[model samples]
Structures are given as structure tokens and as C-alpha cells.
Target: MTSAPAARASMDAGRALPPPVLVVSIVSSYLLALHPGTLPRDATTTAVVTSGFAAVGAVVGMLLSRWASRRRPHPDTQTRRVVFGAGVLIAAGGAGLSVWWQSLIRAAVGAPPVGPDWWVAATVAPAAAVAAIVLIPRVTAVIAASAVALAAGLLAPADAGADRGQPSPRTIVVSEFGTLLRGELAAPEFDHPAERLVRSWMHSGGLAARAVIVAVPTGSGWVDQAAVAGFVDRFDGDVRILTLPYADVPSWKAFISDDATATESSITLVRELAKVLANRPAGDRPRLVLYGQSLGAVGADAARVWLEDHHPSLLAETVLTAPPAGTVAQASRTPRIVVANRSDPVVRWSLGSLWRPPAYPDDTVLGGRRVPEVPWLPVVGFLQSSVDLLAALDGPTGVGHRYGTEQARPVSGLPR
Candidate 1:
């Protein structure tokens, strides 16, 4: 029979190993990073791939844990308890440090500091880390390898389809109907994006458009072209979409400064348009509407504007999809629609940010349930929210932030 020390040492060695799920996650992530062929190399691809890694890691973890349980049952020991305690502390410390780091970064940039979302990340990440440390025996080598592989994935060059050769935003406008509808590019003539949108609106000044939509784009300058197409089709092509553009940051990873710039530009565009449309006959006036998603939605929330006399000509119906639950905006005089999916972290990470059972003139669709004030429960959802954000990209639940063709269909009884 093995001696007590020998058996203990063997069990300890097994406990120290990195979880097989984590090992697979890192490897799969690296492989995906290497093989996203022909897809526009952008943040969406990264989000989708990263989430896939997390999902696989989760599944493998559950299966392995169950199998290990059936092999032998080890009695709880003082040493094991100590190890688990240390891990929990370490995880908590790491999460706290990350939150502090994020705060410093935001302050340095002069942006609104992070809200409850950071707290959620702080709680969730540490718990996850501790779970790995506790469940996987002899995890050092696997952890190091996984880290290295992930680093490789992040550092890899991801530009695909030679996107530099693509057309400018100004050239991508939809002149009439029965043409390309994916509105992705910004108007070219000027360096400032909002100016381009204003000019585009002027170019269509002659049309008797029944409605106009001023859209604020996400960090990547994507205003959901397919969504735009759906919006325009719903309006019977009598509408002109003025997409207010700012810097085309790679993804939602763009700075809060970029968000501020976009918000300011959106405000400028809407104000100018409102000025021009102020004098049109009541029957001939085009209904002004605003659409934004993710970062764009946040910017729209910030651009909350009204005329000197509280006129509603410039701003009418507004649609905000997956807005950050942090910042608060005043209620709009007109119909305000907030669309969100419980699966998206960006929309649910901040406690009290997403208006549960949306009130008043503001109507909200199913984004997520309200965050429980309980200690780490909110944080738990926040972690899942992070992964769900990537899941949102593919509309895995068919009701995520992307909203696809069903985008316009959600706002029932509203004008197109």
C-alpha cells in the first residue's frame, strides 16, 4: 500500500494541473485566430471566436469534472481547504486590481468612470480564476501554455479581404431605391464624419422625403447596414438615412473619447437638420428619427437635445439598442424605444443602468432581467454578459443586439 505522504503527494500533483478545458480553449482560440478566412477582419470576428473558446472551455470543464468525481472520492483535508482559501483571496485581489486599473485609465482619458459593470467583472473574473485553480490539479503548465497561446492569438495580424481598397462612406450612399442597402462607409469629401452626413442630407434636400433617420454608428462606424436597409424598406424608400460618422475605431474597444466625439457630432447634425426642417409645412415635414446601437446607442443617449421652444421637429421617435447601462439620459418628449437582450453583457452589466420594465415614454423590450442587489449575483451575470456580447454578434438567440432583419419589426405600431 502507498504511504500517506506518497498518496497525498500524488493527489496534490493531480490537483495542481491546469484544467483540460482551459487548455483546449486556448488552443482553439489560437486556431480560430489563424483561420478566419475571407471574413472582414474586425472586432465581431474576435468577439465571436473568443466566446467560442469560452463556451468550449465551459463544456469540457463540466464533463471532466464529472468523470473525475466517479473515479475516487477524496476526503476533505486541512491542506486542501487552505489551498482553496488562498485561491479565493488571490482571485478577489486580481479582480479588485483590474477595477482600479480601469478606473485610472478612464480618469486619465477624462471619460465617465466605469460603473457597476467593473464591479461585476471584478467579482466574476476572480471566481472563475479560483474555480480553475481549485478544480484542476497540476494546472501550472497548462495555464502557462494557455496564456501563451492566447497572447499569440491577440498579437496576430487580423486584416482580411484587403479592406483598405474598399470605397469611402460618401460613395456608399443609397440614392433612390432598388440599390445596395448596406450603408457602411462614411461620406468622403471631408475629414469630419458629421459634416459628410450633413452634406449627404443637403444632397437629398430636393427629395420630398416623408421621414429622415439620423443614425449614430458604433466604434467601427457600422450602423447595422442591414438594419438600415430594413428601416428604409419599411418606410417604402421615401426616407433618407443620415449616418453620422466619427472615427472608425476597430471595435467596441475604442476609447470613451471616441464616444464623446461621436455624441457631439450627432448633436451637431441633429441640431443643424432641425434648423433646416423647422420651416417646412406641417403636412410636408419629414418625421425625424434616431437609431444607434452599442457605442452608437450610448452616444445617442448623450446627445439628448431639444429646441429652444421644446419643438419636436428635429427629434421624433428614437431607437436605442443595447445601450450601456451606466449613463443616464433624460426622457425624450417623443416615443423612445430601448431594445436589449438579456444575453448581452454590454446592455446588462451595469446594475440599475438597464431600466427594468422600462417606464413612461420609454418602452423597453427584453434585454435582461434586473440585477439582484445581492453581493456577487450581479457580477455572475456580468461575466456571462461578457461572453453573451460575442454571442449577440451571431444572433444566437435571434433577439440579440445585432437584431438583423427583425430590427425594424420590433417597434410595432411605430412609424417606419
Candidate 2:
């Protein structure tokens, strides 16, 4: 049993990562991947998250390994066997816990239970763990993995069907800011989108509609089509919903980097619309209503505040669904209906949530449906809510970020 090659291999093994370290890295990461979030995620999302977490867990495990190595220096063969065996047992328990979590996630989100996708995730778990463990020990590998994760996150298709609803088919005048995604294709882009949109609307007889609903789009130029359809119903099919695409980037990216695009676009469109309305006879002018959701809400509120300052009587009403935490205060004029789901992370999450509890409207103010209470736990709540934001669009209609015709309800008789 003590051949030269076997003895040499045993000596070299001390330089390699400990077996228990690998087990800790993998099991801990996999468990967190299966943890419950506010909304359901697809198999791909789960796999990517697992891979990313595996990388983080491997780093954490290495730190623990370094600390233990200093205390023990070298472990006897029997001790190594005992530690590895115990780690395997713990890993087994973690696997069981992951299965239990899968069941809960499925039941909570009405997703299919333990099918082919589950098996795929199970297979990916070990591979991702091995890859992460192998790559994390080197500095270049660490940087490469981080870059890949960031790219994957940015390129990932927007939270599955984040803009699922389509615009109404009922002769609803659809005027777009010409060439919104122009720069995306390396095409020569032009300016004066507001003037272009106004010209198009005037030519399309939008001015003749009974109501003009200016729909400010989210950062990615998405307006909830269902909400637009609701606007048509509220106006008795006599409304023209206007949308101007601002940027082709995701809402989060636009929210942080170029929120000004939304503000500037909204102001331009609303200002142009106001001038057009002023030229018309008072009796012929259509009622102007402002609508936006999420980042679109931020932009619409900017324009709403501007309208209040410059032309207080121009805007009849404003409807904002799931507006961001601080945007409502900026657009604080009356006749504004803000529909925010109690479960929506977008409405509650902010940097300040780490230390301070988020401010929420009273139960009576929320009205109708509401999600179960989540006890705020300072930093923990902030972290959980941030994770929930990724799945914000995954819940049932009327819950989380998704809204329905209920968003069209009038603001009358509600507390300011």
C-alpha cells in the first residue's frame, strides 16, 4: 500500500483544495438558489443564479478553509475521511431541502412541479459547481467569471414577458417617436421626436378623439398594452393613446443611467400636445390624461409636475401604476391615481430600505387586493426585496408589478 507513486500523490494532495470545502461551496450555493423569491423564475434563470452563487460560495468556502488550515496545519488521514464523510451527509440534507423548496416555489407560483426542467437544473448544479470551484482559485478566472455573469444578466431576456400585453386593435391611433431604436442598429438617428410624433398624431386624426391619453413608456419603451386598452374602455372607445419610445435599454439600466431621457421625452411630448390643444376650440379639445408605469411613471410624473407649474388646467387626470418610491412626491398635484401593489418590490425597494423601513400607504388606501405581510428586517429585507425585483413581473395579474383594468379607476374620493 506504500508504493512510491502512491506516497508522492498523497503528499501532493495537501496542496489541493479540501473535499469538505468543495462540498460546502456547492451545497450552500445550491440551497440559496432554491430559496423562495417573491415571484417564480424559469429554469435558465435558476441555473444562471446557481452558477453565480456557486462562484461566491466557493470564495467564502476558501476563506473558511484558510482559517481552518492555520489551526490544524495538517489533518491526519482518519480526520480527513471523517470531515469528507460528514460534508457528504450535509450535502445530502441540502439536496433534500432543495427538493422541498422546489415544491413550494411551484405551488406558490402555479408552475409545473418537478418535470424535465428540474432534472436539467439538477444536472447543471454539479457542473456549475465544479466550474466555479475550478475557476475561482485564479485571479484571471475570477475576473472572467464576473464579466460573464454581468454580461449574461444584461443580455438575459427581460423578466419573462415583462411586456406581455399588446396594444388594442380597435383603430387606436399608435404614434411612435420616429426611430426610437435608431442608434441600436448603427443607423443615422434624427432628432425632434416630439415634433414628429405630434405631426403624425395630427395627420392621423388623433386630435379628433374624445380623449387623449399620453402613455409615457418604461425605460425600454414599453407601455402596458392592457392599460392602454383600459384607457380605451374608460373613454368609451373614443381615446387615442400616444407613446414615444425613449431608449432601447432595460428599465433598470435606463432608470439609473438615463432617466433624464424619460423626463425630457415626456416634457417634450406633453408640451407639444398642449400647444396643439390650445389651438383647438375649447369644445373640440379632447381631455388630456397622463399615464405611465414604473420608470414610465417617473417620466410621466416629471411631465405632470411641469404641467402643474406651467399649465395647471391642461391635465385632467394622471394614472400611475407601480410608480417608483420617490416619484409620487414629485408629481404631487391632485387628480392623480397611484396604483401600487403591496407585493411590488419596485414600489418599496431603495438604498434607504437597508436602514429605514419603507413607507407604505395604509390598508384602506391600497384597497381591493393585497399581498401577505412581509416583516421588514432592515438589511435582510433590503437584500430580499432586491432579489425580488428581478422577478417583479412574474406574479399573477394585479399582484407584484402586473396590473389590469383596475389601474384605470378614477382617483375621486381617495386620500391624497
Prediction-by-prediction clash tally: 18, 0
Q: Estimate each model's TM-score.
A: 0.56, 0.68
Question: lDDT of all the models against the reference?
Answer: 0.52, 0.66
Q: Write the per-residue lDDT of candidate 2 for residues 1-416, one digit (tens) a residue.
A: 59999877876764443646555666566556545445555666666666666667776777777787788765655565667667667656765665566666556556667666855665566555556566555764777669889998886646322543432122223435211111111101213666666777676677787777778877666777677667767767766777776776667777778778888778878988888887777777877888888888877878888889887777787888787775556336547877877667778888888898777532213532443444676665676677777777766775567778777666676321
Candidate 1 per-residue lDDT over residues 8-112, each given as its tens digit: 998887566544433444333323322211111123433344334443444455566567667856424544455545544544554455445445533432335
Query: What are the runs in model 1 whose C-alpha is more than 4 Å off?
Result: 1-172, 175-196, 205-207, 255-257, 306-310, 328-330, 351-362, 367-376, 396-399, 409-416
Query: How many steric overlaps does candidate 2 have?
Result: 0
The candidate maximizing TM-score is: 2
lDDT of 2: 0.66
